[model samples]
Target: IMLVSVTERTREIGIRLAIGALEREVLLQFLIEAMVLSSFGGLVGIALATAASLALAHAMQLPYLFNLQINLVAFFFSAALGVIFGYFPARRAARLNPIEALRHE
Candidate 1:
């Protein structure tokens, strides 16, 4: 997805670079974008899981335990995964040749 996004935004990125945006700036932009997307997904998943667990436990007459530590860890892992996976495409965008990218149709 990141790769496709970067591809689709080639012209925009090229314009940014042409207008003096630094590589690190472009990298950070995409990295943050990815992290935000993944973090939102993780939060939704956490909410659903918590709701389902509580509902199931109640249905079965079992104690429902909410583990903040576990959820926080999962969120951290999710964000980390985003950074790891996002780096490649972000790097590709950062390293793009502005002239060539701008020429892209």
Candidate 2:
């Protein structure tokens, strides 16, 4: 998805680069986008798991407990993975030749 986005936004990236946006700034922009996407997915996953566990507990007549620490860790882990996975594409975008990118269609 990130790759596709980078491909689709080549012209925009070119414009930024042409306008003197730093490569690091482009990298940061994509990385932040990745982080936000992963974070949202993580939150949805956490919510679904919590709901399922609660349902199971109710069915078994057990007390449902909230595990904040584990959930936080899971969320952070996902965010970390996002940044790791996004780095390559972000770097690719950052390293794009502005003139060539601007000619992309």
Model 2 per-residue lDDT at 62: 100
Shift in Å, residue 2, candidate 1: 0.8
Query: Which residue pairs does candidate 1 place in steric collision?
Result: none
- For every model shown, what is its TM-score relative to the native structure? 0.97, 0.97
Instruction: Please give the lDDT score at residue 43 for candidate 1.
Output: 94
Q: Per-residue lDDT of 1-105 in model 2, one digit per residue for the tens?
A: 789889999999999999999999999999999999998989999999999999999999999999899999999998998899889999999999999999999
Candidate 2 achieves a global lDDT of 0.96
Off by over 4 Å in 2: none
Which residue pairs of candidate 2 clash?
none
Tens-digit per-residue lDDT, 1-105, candidate 1: 899999999999999999999999999999999998888889999999999999999999999999999999989888888899999999999999999999997
